[model samples]
Target: MITALLVLVAFGSSAQSGYDLWLNYRPMEASVRATQFKAMMSHVYFAGSSPQLQAAREELTRAAKGMLKTAIVNTPADQAQLIIGNIDQIAKRGDILKLSKAERPTGDGFIIRSVTNKGRKAVVVTGGTDLGVLYGVFAFLRHVQTNKDLTNLQITEHPKMMHRILDHWDNPNRSVERGYAGFSIWNWHKLPGYTDPRYTDYARANASVGINGSVLNNVNANVIMLTPAYLAKAKALADVFRPYGIKVYLSIKFSSPIELGKLSTADPLDPQVRKWWKDKVDEIYSVIPDFGGFLVKANSEGQPGPQSYGRTHADGANMLGEALAPHHGIVMWRAFVYDNNVPDDRAKQAYSEFKPLDGKFNDNVIVQVKNGAIDFQPREPFHPLFGAMAKTPLMLEVQLTQEYLGFSTHLVYEAPLFKECLDADTYAKGKGATVAKVLEGTYQPGKLTGMAGVANIGTDLNWCGHPFAQANWYSFGRLAWDPGASAEAIADDWLRMTFTNDKRFIDPIKDHMMRSRENTVNYMTPLGLHHIMSADGHYGPGPWTDKMPRADWTAVYYHKADSLGIGFDRTATGSNAVAQYFPEVRDHFADLSTCPDIYLLWFHHLSWNYKMRSGKTLWDELVDHYYKGAAAVQGMQKVWNGMRPYVDATRYNEVKQLMAVQYDEAIRWRNSCVLYFQTFSKKPIGDQYSKPEHDLQYYRSLHYYNVPGLGTN
Candidate 1:
């Protein structure tokens, strides 16, 4: 009895540690909503016994037990208060719920409704398939968690993108590139022999938000990951995730034919190379039948590709696409490439290289484009490729890890950043052609659409290093599932489910999350500034970093801060990079007066003394943004402190300490950039703002060593 009680205590403690993520399923507060949910979940009938159906049934039972404080009794369809199953199974009951052909759930879509038949009342959750049933179960739990009433429920939902995936940059050696939370969660050394329970929790959290795919390795691919030994380990994980409706994908090295197969050349046109990949793909399928396929990063960042043999990206992708065609798999060929030898705008290289190859790729090849033309900066215009590739499928890839937004130390909610790009009008097929529409394949129907987030998950106690950082992971999954979802609404649900239902706690915290990305942008890269972080780990400001192997890798190459002016000029007169966009977007960005102040410097070089939209000199306006950003961090500290009574001591204190560090770092960023840029402006920081704590030389001389997330490369 003592051991059992100890086990119970241990389980309770672990539940509050944030390892459960947003699916904590804490007990609901006593209220009308709680009573309603308890009654609705009292007697449940879940049809079918497949692994996917069983997983859904398990989740429903677990959630009901936790939130309603009662065991869910399995009952016949007529006696059950809640009926859960696929549409056909639910339809077996006569005249229970009638759905029109258009209203019926399709693909992975689901519908929830309140119905009455033969003097019996029940809430029926039905979907197109077993996977859809799993999603409906999660959505039903979310409604209860957010205190929503289910009496008059009429909800139908479907994922906006066909593939909502997480791209884990985790290495085989248990290190994660750009990961700030902790080491990689996959213990590859022991994987095939031992399956960890954490993997299930990870799948649960992902499924809760409708993420259906996971790529389990870094894009900087390794040949060993394709070996027979590792294949068995990956199969182990695939088996665990299959029940949760997640397909496992692996990132393959482009030269795997040569590196792993001992071939002389990995040319896509080489018959030997082509056969080698086909065999490897066959072996992979034999082990994991539901394998998602390969994600390739080639001809970029020194990774080998078909370019070595003078072949185009389509050649490389098609060769692999042909191998996986039988299994209906795809090749997510990354479009993050640039020639360091070429003296051109780095932002234009991807468009210049890929725009012409638009129609060349096979139907199974999807070119994964980053959200921005460049890497994931604090703020950037949507990638020009979004609407440009009408013939080829494109997937938007956003970073969930805080690589440039202060590396998990600062509270930066990324939903706004994602929405900013998704909502931007691409004007491809006219005014309504937003990036979201392009990603949803609205302009070009019957094409695969997807959104992949760089996974920020790790082995930390909180999963993410910062407690609030988990919100980024949550937000990415939510937005990927429905690009049209509001950031404010998502934050509201997250706050209530993760912390408390108290309005006082939810209201102010939601406001903080909504404004977080903008605040980080203000402090770190206000007014169109990009890529000025320190060279390696990207932890701190390094506006003076000009010594690098390549000019484009240097901060000065992008910012171009000189005595004359600041910012890179990408206009027609400059690199003509603006021409890459459709005329509507190009003309808007090209004209200085019309360009948004937020992106003023990204597309043009402006004088320090140029008049600003706010009627202040450019220099004065930049200074005010820096000060305002730092001050906002202090405001966040005060807001969080007031919530001590609402949150658990563990999570509340974790965020409290992290906020303090955030404020300190915000000051450092403000002072470092303000002082460094002042050298070019030759203007004094206005007396209204506090002077830099130290001189420019002091900030530049500061160096940090052994920073986390600098995995391998």
Candidate 2:
């Protein structure tokens, strides 16, 4: 299958393990279960009929029946083996069933463990709320699915970020922006009548990862979505997601006052425009009372905003936030704005526009900032805006789609990227001011916190295009729930759920994924080389690209590979973009010698002959990275090949075949980039690696003009 057409579909044949994702609820081999999970089914009891409660009941029932391949009989007896209940309903049973409260300060926490219920052995699943019950059920199912002993399973958990959302850049026309997955899941034309079962599965998968909200449209939004007709379409999805505790949000076009309401001006200060938005908010909430509010893309990349009327970003955000305040909704204003025709550095634009407007936003507004200052690159330093605003609610926005990372073809686990940013010490209010602390409300008081991922899900049978890509989605939710959680821990849980819990499968795969993103960065943009892909499609290498209208838009702007040196000088002598960060961070990137070598080239241009810490000249080190990256991918293929017995034949074969594509492409990336940059360095391939198969011109001629199943995010 082409890289772009991987869609999320629920059903696969009973003969294959690919369909189950990490939730493969297949009946365990009788011998294995008898020794491991048989204690899970001595008795069963469930209390409550709320939709969320029923959801938990149904999920557990389906999983248990599927894995055990037998009816788990309900027991009315006091010592039910699998006892389940909401906190209020379960407390009545008293000491006869002493269910210790799970230490979850948040509403969504669950504990499942063995306990003696009136002298009878029981496995109790109890939580403070229905959502907690749902989490408990999933947790319980995971234990059984992973063939773990159910005798003493005690777990309590809650989301770290108040709002973990998936922003689907899906349009009514079925086009998805930057989506490698198939067409949009929202079938607008048939939505009011025909409901796709996929919606339920999407919600279920998100709930499993503790993602509680989803914005159903693109940030480059269309005003038509707010109209009465489309609101009906959105309401259908909201209804399906409500039971799963996932509130639906919409991406609003700032010019909606003019387009949707037929007003003359969409100025933020105008009373008519303010009233128009307020009325629209009221209308939307009337239909979907729990509607999660608006995500706006004002004055960025052709999107209209308050800037159109000489108002700051705050003016636009506060105007909409005021409207949503009464209804308990929020306005997520994007901080991705950069002037289209300006010659200024792209990295400096967003900070310049947003830093001054920080404290002016309404309390209900969250400034949605991307992980990096520039657009999503193969690698980038954490965004300067993270700790710049001390008095405002802010949300971290991460891209799960792999738009700039080799798309679906490359096996890049993004948990490391997420962790790098979350763990970055911002030094805003003093030491220990991490980005996680800022958004999670640990450092800042009374501020609503959030994290969002640009979803890579679509209509594919497997959910994310690549089966392993599903893990990225899983990791994003886990990290959002608790940024302190280790990437390996999250990957371990996902491996057990998506595949076998066998050490052979888990250990090897985990090692491969943990190192995969770094390996990708090593080849594609080592030493901070970024945004060097083909002009339009952004698929392959195009480091020689130039002559665009804006100087910053060209690859030349980022990788200034001249005889003088290479890299954008963000130091005082250059763009001075480093000054945007806090002083602690500012000093780190301000000096070329002091700047971390990983970002050495990003902050300062260096002569090709400059000796690197690796004891090799800069030119040789760059070549080594390209070679090393390609070699690591080959190593991944070998690891996967050895695990043929651990995975289903279909998924195993799918991944195996894709590995061949990745290896071929990795070589292409290596050769093309190395050969192009070698022109400036005037260096040899060296005796360590083989010479390039083709020259730069030959590599450039291999035009991928026909992008199969491309998206426009």
Candidate 3:
């Protein structure tokens, strides 16, 4: 009786850890544990010698141990019920070729099929290569976990995107830019001497979600990273992650010639500077053979670039590209460069700088552009550069960390944000030219085609600070692998794997997860409002702030609120930024009648009494959105409260506490935005809604500085 109680208690505890993520191979209850296949796995057959293949075997062993609660043997005897291998090993067994005829040639393509050869009850996980076999093994395990009968299964899978990567903006000092969870996961001080086990787990988590590469340092790079000492550290991590088919990348400081090489000038046009980078690239490749090349942030936000030396972005990118060309590595030069010095519209800077240089980039260089033109605000129209630079291979860069949307405090699922950009019709080549097509290299994937998520991972036991924030990491990987994947499907799968697979839990939580991003947008920056957060911490609302040095740096510059009304005007009459988009879509945004209502405030400023499509005036609509946002968060709390029985006490209570924080902050946002904007309208907030709890001055005076658990210090 005591043993029974202990067993129940142990089972109860595993349900708590979000560590299982999507590969919770935990055994089902006894009601279904006695099924035929559970007994059929009497022996196993796995054949391969590469590290990737060994990793595949280890994962299968771990899953078998967890689900079957027994040791699985190695040899392929008659009683062997499960077999996993590449096509070469599987075909050695007679007549299995009929089950899967042709072997795929892609490095990471897989085929799983049920076969009857020599009267054996066998399931084969075969792929074109070792990495493919690993993917095949993961796919098979997912099938098992989802309760699919493996008796007669045949499937083949390959990723649509060639390079799915995570760009970690982790500084050498153990800080992550826009990282909300915790300090950097890479313990640089201990590395090269001590290889943290967390590195392998990180690689495993990334590999499971189809992430193929990781840029290990901040794009605002440290020059010391190029030294041999750090190269050895990077090599140590590369060795650990290699087995999982993940390549390590570095963010190259563009001025490394000046910082490290003692060069006179770090000019892209100078032969000395060019030779310095070439030697550096050669040194990096020597340490790590499959080193996924450089991520450069230059000429933006005070970073040194070709512009500093009177050269173009292409000149700087191509110089590095030429150096890496021999090693088959590429350059991901960031297109987030906008003038911090100019008083012009920040939205128009990137477009103006790069559009003229379209088709000028070398084939080995990809321009990494953010989802929005501005820094990752809660909401903004898609970046004008998405379609404008048709000739240059543009890689999509998304912020997985919650930098602008309440950091780690709020429960915001970011699949909607990713989907918003991916699904937007760029109309670059007439209509139907989506950002996904641009990413997949289908529209233009030849030179470079990839999507990079600014990583949110940290040393937290749960990985991301909020347990639910894990969904953003998962969602980014899924979308990177296949840009057309359904956000709802990803959310449902995540809930089942992260928590219980119970319909009651999955249904409501999925609903909540799907609506969470929109809820955040409504509260923080709904209707195209952007960058109105508190100046330093970016934690709370500051819609009334306009005292910054540059006009575009002020909240007033973005929203343009006054006695007249609210929102920036970027039309031809204002900034002429609308002309940046291809005329097919540009015309729609230029004309108020055709522009989508959601973006109306983004591109135009109107009178406070201008009637909206919903029959409310502009002022009334703005207030209504703020009120509705607070109510939505309240609704989310109630929904989460009902899910107590579906998860364990620890995680259940942690999320509940965070949800409370989100609710309180959501109301604070409502109060601050409505009250600040009301000062401009000089209109009553109407007795139906609550008044500001505190005045604008009080809100502005409240400062949250250097908080440990927040982002981008």
Candidate 4:
């Protein structure tokens, strides 16, 4: 009897350490909703019988069983209480839901309505295609999970972008570049024979948020992936992801024709190279019919490309685009390139190289540009290339992995960061021409539109290394589907599904997440100070790392701190990088008086005694921001401590321990930056904050090599 009681107690208090992500349907919270769901969702009449539909059926049944404690039964279409299928399938029955002509959705849109047909109450979920039907099911489940009443449901949602994708930086041997999570989830050696169940779960998580595609390999491409043996392994994974509406793409080495096919030259203008690519593309299509095309990282960071043969980027991209275009696929030619030999600003290289060749790209080619001109810094001005490319299609690339914002250890919410870039007023087509509008084809309607993120997924039990880090993945997919969606609203939705929906828990936690990005910025790269991460590993602060293989690779090169002042002046008197933007933005950012203080150091160097808007000197203001950010982490600890009653013990404890580490790291970042910068400013630490524990020489002597995600380990 004692043993039985113990077992019941353990079962009742099951721990959820975030393995399920936001899809954790943790049982019914409201009795009335449960009863309504049980009554209205008993018999599901699904007309389609594809593998995609099978996945949807299983998802609905799982949610129904978990959320309503009801077993979903399959009944005839005429007698069922719920109906799900494409529009054509529903139209054959006639007047099932009586959806208005104006209500009809096209593309990947769907419609979910609670209707009455022949005196029988039923909820009909129909879409333009089978993929849309699957999306509708996930949407309906979200509504149920969020405790919204489904009595008179009317929701019509279609993706704003055609391709919502995740770009994995996974290497062939299982190393991930800039991936702060664990190792790559793709087990290349075990593939073709052992299909990990986790692959299906990965697809389900992405599909739930409207993400439709994933590039399986790193942009720093390996030519071996094009070999027959690797293609078979990729086909295996693609087959598993097919049911969840995901199309797998690959990153091909630009010199693959020469390296893999033993051609004399991989030049785009060469006939043999062109034929080789066509044959390779055909081989890929045969293996996986629904295969997406290549994502090339060419002529950047020593990656081989057409530049080696005096050919342009468009020349390289168009060659691959022509090969994939015949198969209804595309080529995502990366615009994240820089010149090591050029003395010009590294930020301006991509714009100068690609802007001239914008209109020259083929119809099936897209230039995938990074959010910032520089590497993924904690804070950066939006890339000027967004509005500059009028004739060419450009997709915004944001990093979901925390390479610069404290890796997987820090609790940094990235929705606000993404929204910042998307909502920036480019003034390209007039006053309200936002970056989001430009990418959505507002100026050029005939072009394809899309957004991509560098994925942080790996082999950890919780998926993302940090439990809170999972929210970045959720936010990326949500924003990719609809750029106009508010980050705060998305955070609230994720919070409700991932944890508790109680107002007491939601209100405070949402506030914490919303402030997280800025808090990290303040400590790591406040007031436009960027890319000061410690060498190669980028694990911590290293502002004094002045010597490296190249001047651009060092922290001192960008910050340019000296005895006179600090900052990289991008005004006409300096590099004139601001000229890349529209006249409105160029003038505003160029003027020291007009530029916001948040980006003051980014555009111009200032005296240490210069007065800030806060009426404090620049030195005092910088030190204050650093100290306050570290203190905020302590406050976060207090907030999490108060919500122990609401969160599961496993998650609560995990976050608590992690927050403790974050507090220490926050202190490390704050002190190291302020102390190092002080060497140049020749100023004392702010009176409010404590002095650094060690001297500048002491901090610089510290070493942290062989960190995870550097591709070495």
Candidate 3 residue-wise lDDT, 150-206, digit = tens: 668878788877778999989888887778877898989998998877787788778
Cα lDDT of model 2 by residue, 379-437, tens digit = 88999989888888789999999888777788889999999999998889888899999
Least accurate 10 contiguous residues by lDDT in model 3: 1-10
Q: Each model's C-alpha lDDT?
A: 0.89, 0.83, 0.82, 0.88
- How does candidate 2 score on lDDT? 0.83
Q: Which runs of model 4 end up more than 4 angstroms from their true locations?
A: 1-15
Native-referenced Cα lDDT, model 3: 0.82
User: How many residue pairs clash (N, CA or C atoms closer than 3 angstroms) in each of the candidate models, in the order given?
Assistant: 0, 14, 1, 0
Model 1 residue 248 lDDT?
Answer: 97
Indicate whether candidate 1 or candidate 4 has the larger lDDT.
Answer: 1
What are the clashing pairs of model 4?
A: none
Error of 4 at 301 (Å): 0.3
TM-score of 2: 0.95
Give per-residue CA lDDT, model 4, range 199-300, as digits (tens).
888889899999999999999888889999999999999999999989999999999988999999999999999999999999999999999999999999
Name the regions of candidate 3 deviating beyond 4 angstroms.
Answer: 1-17, 31-41, 77-80, 91-94, 97-105, 149-152, 708-713
Ranking by lDDT: 1, 4, 2, 3
| 617 Cα displacement, candidate 2 (Å) | 0.8
Top candidate by TM-score: 1
Worst 10 residues of 2 by lDDT: 1-10
Model 3 TM-score? Answer: 0.95
